[model samples]
Target chain A: MGLTRTSLTAEIGRGANYTDKHDCVVALAGNPNVGKSTVFNALTGMHQHTGNWSGKTVGTAFGRYTYDERTYSVVDLPGTYSLLTHSKEEDAAKDFLVNETPHLTVVVSDAACLERNLNLVLQILEVTPKVLLCVNLIDEAKKRHIKIDIGKLKKHLGIPVIAITARSKKDIERLKEEITRATDNPSESAYTVQYDDEIEKAITTLREGGVGTRFEALRLLDGTPEAGGDSVPSGAADAVAALQIARTAAELSDEIAKALVKTAEFIAKEVVFVEKATDMRREKIDRVLTGRIFAYPVMLLLLLLIFWITIVGANYPSSFLSNLFSSFEMPICRFLQRLGVPQFFTEMLVFGMYRVLYWVVSVMLPPMAIFFPLFTLLEDVGYLPRIAYNLDRCFHKCSTCGKQALTMCMGFGCNAAGVVGCRIIDSPRERLIAILTNNFVPCNGRFPLLIAMTSMFFISADTAASSFWGAAFLAAIIIFSVMITLFVSSLLSKTLLRGVPSSFTLELPPYRRPQILSVLVRSLLDRTIFVLGRAVAVAAPAGIVIWLLANINVGDASLFAHLTDLLNPLGKIMGMDGVILLAFILGFPANETVIPIMMMGYMAEGTIKGYESLSALKTLLEANGWTWVTALTVVLFSLMHWPCSTTLWTIKKESGSLKWTAVAFLLPTVIGAITCILVNFVFGFTL
Target chain B: MISLSYTPMCALSPGECGTVSDITLGGAMRRRLQDIGLIPGTSVRCVGVSPLGDPRAYEIRGAVIALRNDDAEAVHITR
Candidate 1:
């Protein structure tokens, strides 16, 4: 890894030279919503889930770009405002810079908001001197009449600086070439963020005592520096020596933080010139979006519009897919039998596993396919933080950080992702509150069932009026679940995870024009297909297990019947029958399988199937003694039940406690049970 | 000590701009605030509040950051 100069032209020329692969590692760090992920995508050609919001990248995403006939592996570290804080995600960013010591750390900053973005850049410079300043989103800045003197910033920061908009291929190639050159000849910055006199004296004392570096002394002075656990991999002398620094440099002080902030404010003022009209333009839009009169209505309207679009768009494709899958049953059975398959095997494979797979795919796929991309479009446009802003008071009242609103939004897509998104919340207690209550919102897998039931039972018989009322009613149900989320979050905070709300700086970023094409493709691949693939995997094994439960007879009745009979009394108290309760229990592996399991229980012979119409499904439920009360109770339970297996696993992984995992499981289940029993108990007296 | 001329940051209305006179917040959060350029002498403008009107967005250091009412009131400012 000696310094060998790779010419810029040679680096930019594709397939122009053949040499040994360098495998140079480069890490991208930035403030949230600074087009950091876009730079990663441009450099590595991997669509790494770019979005225009804070904490969009919850964890590191890795990709490789080839330059100068050498492959440069890039790690996109999660965006943070400053590494000065003790946030888990920020610690991850700081840890990577300190420990892994990537060959070059490209500190990406939004050129438009260079003043605030420099706060993080200067902090990273403290950790290691091997940093290249890539001031991104230059085009947006230029459009807003903000000009940054890249050369002046370079000299002031005393680091190599380059400004490039992520859109231009030429700029990305230049970035790659710069990566090569910077990695080859690393220059220590002459500029340092001068702290106040007191901290400087302390640093000097620690420095004289062989504390390795000024940065190490500062880190040791941090309230809680995550250090010294695993620095062996990089084997950098700085990492090793930093591990030896005494923890007695100084108490965490305002002088150090203020100095950093003051320096950033100074440099930004020196290098940037702005017309200042852009904020006014965005403020008008934000006023309407988060304005008192229109905020909730606009949110509800957006939710309704998305649901209406999904319900209407998914109708034809769902039917087509179902018809296509069903139309193949006989041929598949015939082909299997002709190959000398046994009846039991044929029944299990085709009628059981295959039927369940197709049913889940047809029913679950279309809506998710439509809904996720629409949701991703919202995320990309930076509407999420505004949502957090609008809903902050509600969360504050609940003693939780408002960012839970964003995680709850993710829960609308998938509970697992929502749990993972809880990483954005700074407080461990609030993060738990967010995780435990995330399941109160129905995920995409549960949405189709809720919509179906909402339409079938709640609305009037007029087809003309039903569609509008259906969307309204669906939104009402979602709101009810969100209310439950707040209630539970508050309850748990007061009882189990009680604490004052942690302060967080919610940055409402400038909205970017969403990449609609790539959003469609990425959502379809990343979210829809990924979730669908998990459903399929779970649904198949579940199908075979459920077939055994339904078919294998115990006593005079089948095992499924006996099991339902066992649960019948409890189910009666909950307003749903034994079979529905059993279906929910069996559906624990995957919520997508709940409908098929219920269908199997209601229709005799246990042969899996899909109904052609919502009307037909309604008729079947009515025949099975489902009144509007039953339907209401069912929706309530669906909205407030135990999280599915994937979500539980994610909760376990994220929370890292079996106790919390069990609490997450039982909290919702208990609430759902109590809510259902009370509903049934009250209706039992009145209706 | 509390100053006579400094107004509670929560009192600032939309379109009103102020220079931060003091931050009376404590602990890590106070440091967090300072780390983002919210120290004394930085200019902060009350952009607008969310519909619920608790967490208000303030333009600090060329960025719009919304702080909850409780957090906002901790910062003392003067027009």
Candidate 2:
């Protein structure tokens, strides 16, 4: 079946566009890690951060640039080695070429390894003649002592070839000029792959009969029936079916692929040269990083280092933001009161809505701001794929794609983004499995809760030891979440989405010196601000709801307490109280609001409350009869519970099925409930 | 020299190198293998194995790629 309209619209909606208007559409295609996005950003002046891993650009990103007083809208297609594969990225790049039929398709190639990259350029050349080969990363190639004869390459391919160092904005103006020329006057190159006799005959017949272009027919014969949509008359269908059956029987795809590879090799040899090849630094690094004995320890140390940095670095900014926002609460409240608003209205608006929003910002922003950049730095340094490589076997044991590890890493920033990142997994079933299990990883929003509870219960003393222990405990909880994620993924694949784990080319790209400024800007704007905006959007409505629930009473107790009473028994069985359960239910909008809601519930006040420190929060919890069991249970429950509403909405949009959305919701909630009950049972008996 | 015997890629020890002989798989897996420049006649070198000893990294066409033993087994190579 074709992609549903909803998903297509959602995918398009995620891309950057310029006011729904443009003079021309130019498509950017490239192999992963080839600086396609860098070129796009430089050309469009957009800040789409270049991720240094395969399939990181999992969706189309559009940007607009003005050339010769004409606005050219550039579509950055997902990086793919070849459009022949059935992966979502390949399909996205291929389908846009076929369906959207853009004015020009610019194929970006890495100058460091133009031979391997030429394979994709040849494939794109087959589909569309309106093509320009952009050999990017010339500086990197020069550093590696490789050279490309660009003039000879352009002559050999009979197409415009522009050499550029995307990082330095070198030759970008020439690129813009070339784009203007190529789009205005499309030219066909002499590049063509000569398949074996049988495939060639079949392609010729199909092309002559108007079934499709030779490239389209070859794609169909290469077992992509989805590519035959444009030529689907009854006669053409019969001819296509006969051709497919014959081709399958003959096993001609391999032969055709061999021919394409030969052509690419030939062209590469003609156009590219390597001089004084030095020892690859990446190999030496990989020997240590992915070595059998040191890999796990190194991975663990890195994880701890990131968390340690986040935990320590975030405190000052978090406290500063908290003090800053809290200081405004009184002034804002007084201002509202002075405006002749009633006390209750003022309290609801200021203390309830405003307080929760500020608290969420203060708590969630610092960690996310610190964590996402660190994560992106790792990604930019090409370390994330190694993490995926390290975890591939574990995920394979769970009968899911190893790419899920990368999505889980993204989930650490925001589960919604993780849910979207599931698109990187080509298989629908595995993508669903990734989406359903993503929330098992604690996001930045949940980090505050995990860190706070760990500090309050286990690391009671306000010492350096306490902070270290707190970070370690937080790390332990994260590891536990990962374990639960694997367990649930295994169970789901076996039961619901049954399949063996599929293999993908997990390209361990060469490590580059990360651009720190770009990493900071990208992590802050693309990740931190985006997620914080979402939290704030959901937190405001939740604030008013929490206020109403605490303020409105049935008889003697408020509705909040009544709901707490309803869930109190279940909460007790889970080693948590009713107010905590009520808080979780109300905190559905955003996880950062959960603790604030609980604090408000305990105070029995009509408004949310903020504490200056974890110790003060712990003191407040102690007043409400919290113990070690309660703290442990809350941490465990927070680790396992239903994903926040943002994640759920993302799930619904990604899965495009409420049934799966319901499954995604209930899967974690059920697991969380059961885990809490079991933890509480054992702790109750032991303590 | 064309070696008649083909060994699965998983048989290669870490740091061992081999040329791809044939891919005994079909559909997306086969296409993906080829897309990453792992076609027949291309040389692949086992660079390292993960701590778990299942998924191993191989250097192919100047790029390091990780493949599980299961997928590696489908790749017939000749040393």
Candidate 3:
């Protein structure tokens, strides 16, 4: 409710001019995967997110750095190809440059891929004259033996260009020095892109410099809002009258694009020299990864291996943390009592809120800590795009963009993140389909329960062999859920969100060595702690609510019992009793607390949230009629149910339509109930 | 003299190289393609094919891009 630190910093980053203040805003702009974030992290301290692939920086992350005793607020704009395109990232980058007009803007580019990177630099120059070119990733260029002439490039660009590795401390200092100069002097006109004679003559007809530069004129002719979804605004009719041009807007845009590419190519040829790009190393790896025989095998094997590692590794820490939390419970209760605190509040605080929060953290943190890092390592190795490439065909068959594969991968970490990741999908129809169906992939919160259920029911005993079988079973459930996602995606594509699959250019970036230290640190902060924070936020209230529900009486029994009995018939039709169904409804807050709440219902408070053994859990479940049918039904329902509250909130914001959010919720709930009923019906016939 | 043979970019198998002759895709994809240095005379090579042989990876101006058959089929190339 009050002014928090993130909110305060966010205000400064919302395109606010600070010329009157001590802080001068320096905006970092660049192409995707060009080490812009690497530079951002280095200057603003080491805690920000940096990844190997594109689209990692989905928003404008803010931090502050100081040089020459003057503070500079650093705004990391979303990486984009060019300011002219209409992708969300491009729009943000363009909007920040044009609207905010920060004191100084730094254009970060990759030294190895200078030509493609320069395409953005030129566009940024046209947007604002106060731009400093930062040719980062110089180390990677050195390895490739590609040399760039800084002097000649400066002559061509007519701006200050600094070539330095983002990691080097000395380079950052040099960059800081240049920031001082560039802010003080927004000097000397940047290289003007010479279009064809007709286009240049048309630019002369329109106003030139200050509020209406040649870029604006070119955009008026080319950037019509109706033409290719480009954003030149809707007021181009007056400009069209002023120009009296004959060509179509698309043709002028094409000519501008060709001119830009040719300019970038011409400058690149003159200043950049290459012996040979030994991208051969990456191609060799791709030969195995994308080869017909080994492709799917490698993918399945990596998934299986990651699951096996997560299942086996998360076991000890989970139990240890559980035991650790429970051991402190009695002391805290006594401590509160001795302080003359009321017994009712003391009991509720320790038993209700503390227990649920502990369960969420203990069960969720370990698996997420292990799993997110491993997944991020694959991203760092540039394998996520290959996964998208290999699976694009199947997604296209479902009438969606292939980038849904990437969003589905993000779903494995957190479905809320997966829904946000759908922004990368260009078409609204495909993005909506991706968001709605994302719940079919079990996120890390659901993983602990899936692991627990398979261990108790599917695996006969707890041994190495049993755990292997358990991991394999969990993997099978994941595969089943993904198949359901594809099926539901196809169904939605054919009906509600009907459209042909969209075409997107997916860049398969060169595989770089995984920065293991940075990957571990980033995933730990970004995924594990972030997801755990949300879980704890939900679990605290959920714990208190469940405690009150069990404690508050309604006639003879507690409200918990009355509610369970009321929902029993409906739950019975799905093979699970009312309590199991109630657990899912209560679990809407966070998936991590579902089992803990279920245990609370069955035993009514004994051995809840921190069970003594699998055998104890088995007895409680078997007492509630948990055969293989019940276990399988519960598992399927857990996989394909309404998303947790966090994900539904994300869907509402991302889609901006309550109808779509309701569809996202009801689609899976109906599918889950029907599948559970089918399972029970088949089991009724057989057994 | 061998006449220049033109084929859709999707037709180039792995390890094949060609020059972009024309781009026929409309809307944003066409603008994006040209913006990324895939003009008429730019050199491109098919570096890798996906397991399904539908979306192939092409190397253009030092960056590798994977295009689906629907988009790649619009670009005519001459080897």
Candidate 1 or 3, higher lDDT?
A: 3
All candidates in order of DockQ, best leading: 3, 1, 2
- Top model number, lDDT: 3
Ranking, TM-score, top scorer first? 3, 2, 1
DockQ of 1: 0.76
Question: Candidate 3, residues A284-365: lDDT per residue as tens digits?
Answer: 9999998899998898889878877876799899999999998999999999999999988888888888987787788888
Each prediction's number of clashing residue pairs:
0, 0, 0
TM-score of chain A, model 1?
Answer: 0.91
Residue-wise C-alpha lDDT for candidate 1, range A367-462, written one tens digit per residue = 888988898899888898889999999999999999999889888878877887787787899999999999999987888788878888899785
Q: Grade the docking of candidate 3.
A: medium
- Give candidate 1's TM-score: 0.91
DockQ, each predicted model: 0.76, 0.68, 0.76
Backbone clash pairs for candidate 3 read none
Q: Total clashes, candidate 1?
A: 0
Off by over 4 Å in 1: A1-22, A196-198, A221-252, B1-5
Clashes by residue pair, model 1: none
